[model samples]
Target: MPMKKKPTNICCFLPDEIVENILHRLPTKTLLKYKIVCKRWKSLISSTSFKRLHENKSLENPVLILFSRQEGKPFLTTVDLSGAVLDRWDLASIGLQNSAFLPSPFGSDNLLCLVVDMQRFFVCNPSTRRACQICLPKASMHCPSGISKASFGYVPDRNQYVIVAKFKGRRNWRMITLSRDDVVVSAGNIDERWKIIKDSARYRVADGSPWGVFADGILYWTGDADDRRCLTCFDLWEEKFFVVLLPDEIVMIQEYQDDDQWLVELNGDLHLMYKKEGQQDIELWKLDGAGDWGWSKQDMCVAGFRARFGAHFRPVMMDEKGEMLVYNGGFMEWYKLKHEVFRMGGKGYKNIHCHAEDVILDFKLHIDTLL
Candidate 1:
């Protein structure tokens, strides 16, 4: 009699392509744990191509990432629009202890560029709990107190991450570029990585604008001079600075306090949200054509909320149904465009409680991925 055929494992019959498609759909945490399953699975999951695929899949199910600190311990919380918590991460677990601030307004490719204690710079993948320290120039390291402001962005065409920073008592801006492959920079090659950007326009960023709002491959900050009242634009690709004039209506308003206006990115377009004096409504001006200086305005009403308090709220995410998730200093609230009302702590909303002293460092929309 012939020997019985040996039993075969079902996983072995699956193609690498099929396995990859299945694996990419899983959460980053699951994939990270699955790395120990086999050498082949580990190699495939850790590849750059697989990371891109996982990130693309995550974009379809994005969530809000809130960075806050309670009693000096930093926390990163991921929640949906309904305020349901999905995952929470303690930044101290990844060696980010006593972090003075967190990356605000935006993240590139789901990767966060963080500055700790205004001195140590780090690039972190929050999903996989991977962090890399970026090397700064000697001047910056020697006098960390001089580091006034820093903005981070990704250049898609070149596949690089760029950081532009302004130093106190310095006219020229400094920049550091990190390639996708070189996520970690060593101290030995610091000089070769940092560059000094020539400021021909002599643009000065406003004092209150510490972080820039990045949109369309450009980093924008409020201009310092009152006469100018414009936006200082830094093109990442060209490494040049230019000025974009603000709308005449906003500039002409006599009671327009710099604090009343906030720059945010909505639907991939730059929007300027400004509140007029003695008005309960806010004006949202969308930048239509940067070259032609085209702008369209829409009024948003937030009833029962003071204009001063409402001015701090900025839209972080918008859904297909025209609902928005707006962030104040630390908390988040939902706004329904059709109903024109803010929703919080009710039947359809969840309340995020925090102590009076608890400080919210920053918040942004993030797609948790292996990257």
Candidate 2:
């Protein structure tokens, strides 16, 4: 006969701070399951401070979020740089079928804003399987053409999430702010939450441009005003609007003819990308300094796959090895910086093509976390 030794307790050897540091590095899915380990672990995982810590850790290895619709159901897929699937969510499981996800360059605190039936809006956290429907003002709800331009962003200073939108035939923009604690609110008395922002600058967003690119607490839109192409910037903290003029070279290029141009946030700075039709090179202009209003230009040659489809691509994210993940409105491919060639088909590349039948609604770099 032998005596069985009691199971050793982990808390006796490891401190609380060390335990939290170790848990923060775990994946969101694993952490969720570990919540049942004990009461202490469950409380630590669900705390607001812990969620913020986990979010920062996740940012180091961000993934690509593909929002698409297949068979009339919305699907969200997260993939790594190697084109490996990390996670997938059938939004219909959470009663969000046929919803359109609003596109934002920098995702809003791991939360998604979805538009349902062109009238109702919902703020959802797919990781936690929680969603809250936001009530809109009467004027905003009656738009015949629905919301033309909309963006969802987070304000770090105020710890609030804001939604900015413009409806058809509306001269001013409408906005609603939700604090972190009030993200999921009662829909009974939310009508007065929306406010109209007067457009003293009279900035009109371009017809076919994407919604908005948020960087450093500001939302920017590519548009033309006063017969000139400029950037309309809305400061979330100040609740004011300003214009940033494009470089003389870019303006000259736009004046001559129409080019495929879009705004993106790269490395926490706003970048303007444009490629002329029938050209193999794409031009990128980075805003050197927001205060100084300086611009630096770089050209990326895309002759690797131009012979086949002749499609242009935009940089979505740069990996640790300095390689770029680019998207061309249809498919995503990696551009090896050292080799200067695009990697289309390989071992990991097939994972993306597996979902080719689904209609891609939006794609962006996102950091998935427990929050």
Best by TM-score: 1
lDDT of 1 at 199: 57
- The residue-level lDDT of candidate 1 at 66 comes to 68
**Candidate 2, residues 1-371: lDDT per residue as tens digits?**
99999999786677779989999998777889989888788888989899889999888777777888888888888777666777788888877786777755364475777776656678766556456776546753554356677777788767788888776666788888876455444545554688889863276778765477777777888877687888877888888778888887667663434345667777677877666555645566777655676778755544433433344455677555756677665666777755667677561243453276777667677777776
> What tens digits encode model 1's per-residue C-alpha lDDT throughout 1-371?
99998877545677999999999998777898888887888899989899889888888777666677877778877765566676778887777776644333344464677776666577766676565675446663444345677777778888777888876656678888776445533335533577789753387778888778777778888885557588887888889988788888778777557776788888777888776666666667887755675678854554534454454565777666767776666566777765767666452334442335546667777887776
Instruction: Provide TM-scores for the models.
Output: 0.83, 0.81
Candidate 1 lDDT trough over 10 residues, lowest sum: 347-356
Clashing pairs in 1: none
Please give the RMSD of candidate 1 to the true structure.
4.5
